[model samples]
Target: MTTSAPPNPSGEDESPAAGTSTTAATSTTRRTTTVTSKVPTVTAAPTSPTTPPATQVTTSTSAAPATEIPDAPGPLSPAARLEEVGTATVDGDELVVVAPSDTARADARQGLAALEIWLNGGDPGSTWTTFAATDPTSDGWRWAAVNRRTGAVVYIR
Candidate 1:
């Protein structure tokens, strides 16, 4: 299903089979040039081994604007940070960690958001278990939470 252009004598591709024709364009103009150059050599007299190159030092007097350092963010309370879960919402007293949408794209920021939510006010470690698993039907990645004490699945998406 492929064809190559015919070999050309001038080294420029002029093959019509290659989707290009250069015959008229190539004959429009011609150029010729000649170049000349001269180089001179000189010998230097040897100096004493103790002689060193002169050194020059310079300093600028212009004052530069002072850069202000930004204040660091204060520490976040447990309720301010999200757990490794994607997103979280408060439903009554329970903290629900929602999985990130694959179509929307998942990344480290989402994971950090989840972690922050978990740290903030999500379920305590003793109440729920968060684990990653592959869905058997679609073979896609998923995160699920199970209530340890109740043996109930919280969310899977």
Candidate 2:
């Protein structure tokens, strides 16, 4: 008597070919083993002989514009911008400081103190000396502290 084998779960043929492994066993018991793979199988669609392949185009949202940015303005120059305005006047080589009101004078004094602090490293010591009336020496930096808002000037040597 002959017995037939069972079908595979995936419906694919797993049986040995005809005339292959034709050795006769001593026992009637049959042990069937099926192996499954974890890898997946991919299949491409059937294309016609005269049909052309398709093209793909991609765009990026993070791309920036190619326009040029404007240049920023630099710090103001005291000599060029800070001229005699309002009550401040120029007396020969010196700047004669004359404010319109007491408030203007106070502001001018604050500006003068700021300029002095800037020149003397926050502490104006004996390094800051007044120029002589008769013979003024050109040794250190001579600056005219001008208030940009009120246009008040104070000359320092």
Candidate 3:
């Protein structure tokens, strides 16, 4: 979901369709941030928005190389970009992921990786469909998604 013309490779046209691969993008109707669908020849630029904040980055270190990926594909697929997560809570005034109690335990990026791995193997059972979580106070809550088939709660904020 996007809300306006997304910022692309700094100064390039913000056209949703103008995006190449690598750079992160948001929908024009909602604030859903994600990456383009393909890997670009050029290394993608850093800095894409998330539910936590617009400037937050999950870096390993100051020298760690940065990567830019596109949005996750349809349901049951490994999320290339975190935005592929379907929203959990829908009643809030602002859009954000509402983490569940287990959010802290299974929330490292590795969990996201695991979910991706599971998805990559082809969502085997029908136990998990998809779901979102709710935080008590964080404005709009954080964006959280759940596996309906396995009862797995993966926090993608």
Question: Please, what is the whole-model Cα lDDT of each candidate in the order they appear?
Answer: 0.40, 0.41, 0.38
Indicate the TM-score of model 1: 0.22
> Candidate 2 has which clashing residue pairs, if any?
none
Residues 17-102, candidate 1: write the lDDT tens digits: 45544444423333333455677777798876896659867787987755332221122223332333434443433434433222
lDDT of 3 by residue, 1-157 (tens): 3234555544556455653455444433434446578765886689777666667776674665533221321232232233322332223332333223422333333335443434344442343333232442342223333444234444444
| 127-152 per-residue lDDT for model 2 (tens digits) | 22222123223322244444444444
Q: For model 2, what is the error of residue 38's alpha carbon versus the real structure, in angstroms, after optimal superposition?
A: 99
Alpha-carbon runs more than 4 Å astray in model 1: 1-124, 135-141
Per-model TM-score versus the true fold: 0.22, 0.23, 0.18
TM-score of 3: 0.18
Clashes of 3: 24
Candidate 1, 64: how far from true, in Å?
79
Order of the predicted models by lDDT, top scorer first:
2, 1, 3
Backbone clashes, candidate 1: 17
Model 2 has an lDDT value of: 0.41
